[model samples]
Target: MTNAPFVVMKAVAKRWNGQLGVEDISLDIDEGSFVALLGPSGCGKSTSLRLLAGLEIPDEGQILIDGRDVTTSAASDRNLSMVFQSYALFPHLSVAENVIFGLKVRRVPRAERAKKMKRALQITGLEGLEHRKPGELSGGQRQRVALARAIVAGQRLCLMDEPLSNLDAKLRNSVRKDIKKLQRDLGITVIYVTHDQTEAMSMADKVVLMKDGRIQQVGTPDDLYNRPANTFVAEFVGAPPMALIQSSVLGGFDASLTLGLRAEHVSIVSKGEGQLSCTVSEAEFLGSETLIGLSHEGTVGLSVLQPGLALLDEGTTVDIAFDAANLHKFNQEGDRMSEV
Candidate 1:
């Protein structure tokens, strides 16, 4: 892998009907790295992907691939492959045909196309189903066909836009692992777009989180989870999300500040032994851990992820405490305050 970034977006901005699709966006993607563009709908993740693919030209920025400006390049000229949410496979074509479609269009020799098709099929685990049509295959298989097509293109960069959104939960998990493994095996640079944080955290080396047309944070999954740059990142990055409580509830912090704590970080302690007290509002049994939802003096709702089945009934009072070192403090503007 190269030491320099394989893809670069400098001051990229896109506008649609006087509204910003993505504003002042700049990102560097290292060669052979997996980067996820993550956020909810309309947050510009898809827009950014399109810009990189040359489907959408930026209003004010330069896009360079391998140190050459491709801002005005055509999608085909960019030499990148894209896999979309819909699978985008031709219903009339067989899996093998679909996988080799790009090579055929480029007038590659039949022998070369056949070799690449077989290699892509084997890598994507679609080896035996080459003769099947998209309509005859399961959702996961069809997705693999799409992936095989991208792989057969032999591009150094691959772009994915919510490619697993159509799969069932079980299939999504299976295919997610396959995609990550395939990227690693191929050593291709990948820019994946997804609203699912779990996918971003589990697959990508770096996560670029976006909100309302701008980047909210860019870092490793651990960095976003353990040291969020602000309240939005703190709330959005975690599962069960982070519980934020007003500083007044704890007494010693600034009144205008909020304290953030992960559900896993807060433990239930004996009454009077903890820093704060709460009444159990709900208890959810999730096999490996029990999620105890609590209401603290009508001010904030907090969740405690206690290991195993430690069922605390509703209305039962419990004391909860977290390590002071693990607390995340955010000021009135929702920006994180530096550690004291």
Candidate 2:
């Protein structure tokens, strides 16, 4: 609506020693949107961030910040702040010093810097811990310091590369919510990069799924999960991912396709048309839910999620059903296809 993101990348590409780092790609990230670059390691997601941050110059094409060419601009001139996965705080500095490090480097007035430092600490829930060193705080607390440092810099755009990777599962989940809330309250444009699909789905307003140096798809989380553009997305997203039947059993039919259904969508419904018979192979209890692995006619394997505990034995036969509307069809080349 309003001139989307004030950032743009046009025909961007990067290569190193004849190996592609990122292929020609263009994107428009509107202001105040939390856009996540989601992909596996070595998938060019990080490379895209470097280019945007001016940490790496593009091999070709240009970058525009609010319609101004900044392709050749120095990293310092980019007016952006970044938080790395490592929580790269100066080891000897206390939390307060770390948060104001950027301001000091830019020679911001002492009084202004102090005011912003207090604000950053309060915003990140680090006010009382400002004097503590990174070594003295928990991993979650350390990451919050890094976030405060980025915000204190007063950059309109913030780039984060796996900021929660250092925490354990419980801490990761807790910090993820905190970060999302912070982004909302600040209303700052953020480009977050991570390989964890859960993080992307939970936080991003727009998710950019990447693979092998190219963008696979860019859409809202619901768009990617319910309407993947290809098999790769279906297999990569969702917890436990979508259960895929490698080849359809409808003999002589278009067996050159794979069927995609999320674990929660594939259920043991009452017998119905298009139902695929499967035998239970294993069941796992995950406290809030149960994961049941199934195989159809002893060949096609799949997994499903059911609320509460599963009561079936390993060999019990069950009809695994899915709503055709929730199904995604992919061709052998991994491209998605719409049913006729």
Candidate 3:
């Protein structure tokens, strides 16, 4: 990482017709750092990436790369690379040709283009498949081809818009690891856009979460998970999602307050031996752990994670407890009140 910022977005805003695409978005990307723009569909994450790519011009604010203003510059003039979800490769071109297309367009000598092509293919594990066309490759392999295209450019910044959206679960995980390793090895800055929290949390050094064209919070994965800025972040950044309860139901808390607890933090104990009592409403076997859903007094519903096949049947009563130290408090406005 570098001390000076490599990319800066100052209050950038984009609108389509009468509607806003992204509003007042600002960010500073450190050199060699991987940042993720995360949010649901239509939440402006992709739009933000396009803005940085110069595919969409911002109606307000400015974008600077390496301290150079490129707000209104062409995408090619920005000296950045982009990998799309569609793996936009020339169907008729061989893998090697596709990877070296940028160098060819830039009129690099044949020897220089070949050197870059070879290096890109080797880095992406596509050395043996260099002769194959996009049609002959698997989904993961094609994605690698697209990555090779980006890496061959040797740019300081790379913008990825849901690059793994087309891969299956198993392939997605494998390629995710490969991409992270490649980024570290190359020491290039990346801004990836994704709706999947798992991908964002696992890969990014920093996450910029968005909602309705505006930023909700920006933080590390642990920071977003442990200390969400508001209820929206608390509910969006988790896997099974955090369970929110009315504070009044837990005793000695005001009715206007809410409590947030993670499934892993809630432990099941014998009846009368825990802080709260509930009846099991549903149980799911998730290979290494059991997800037990509990309904309390026909009002509050919560999920708890129990290790390795603790099969409690539906309708069975179990007490649940969590340390006060793990509790998160929120006021009526949905903003974080305190970390208990």
Candidate with top TM-score is 1
lDDT of 2 by residue, 1-340 (tens): 4665588999999999989999987899998899999999999999999999999999899999877889989989998999999999998999999999988988999999999999998988897997888999999999999999988888889999999888999999999998899889998999999999999999999999999999999999999988888978887887777767655563433778776777877778665543777788899898888999887752333788888886578998788766767766788888889657
lDDT of 1 by residue, 90-142 (tens): 99999999999989999999999999998998898887898899999999999
* For model 1, the run of ten residues with the poorest summed lDDT: 293-302
Q: Against the unseen true structure, what C-alpha lDDT does each candidate score?
A: 0.92, 0.87, 0.91
TM values, all candidates: 0.97, 0.93, 0.96
Better of 1 and 2 by TM-score: 1
Ranked by TM-score, the better of candidates 2 and 3 is 3
Q: Worst ten-residue run, lDDT, model 2?
A: 244-253
Residue 193, model 2: lDDT of 97
- List the candidate numbers ranked by lDDT, top first: 1, 3, 2
Output the better candidate (1/3) by TM-score.
1
- lDDT value, residue 56 of candidate 2: 93
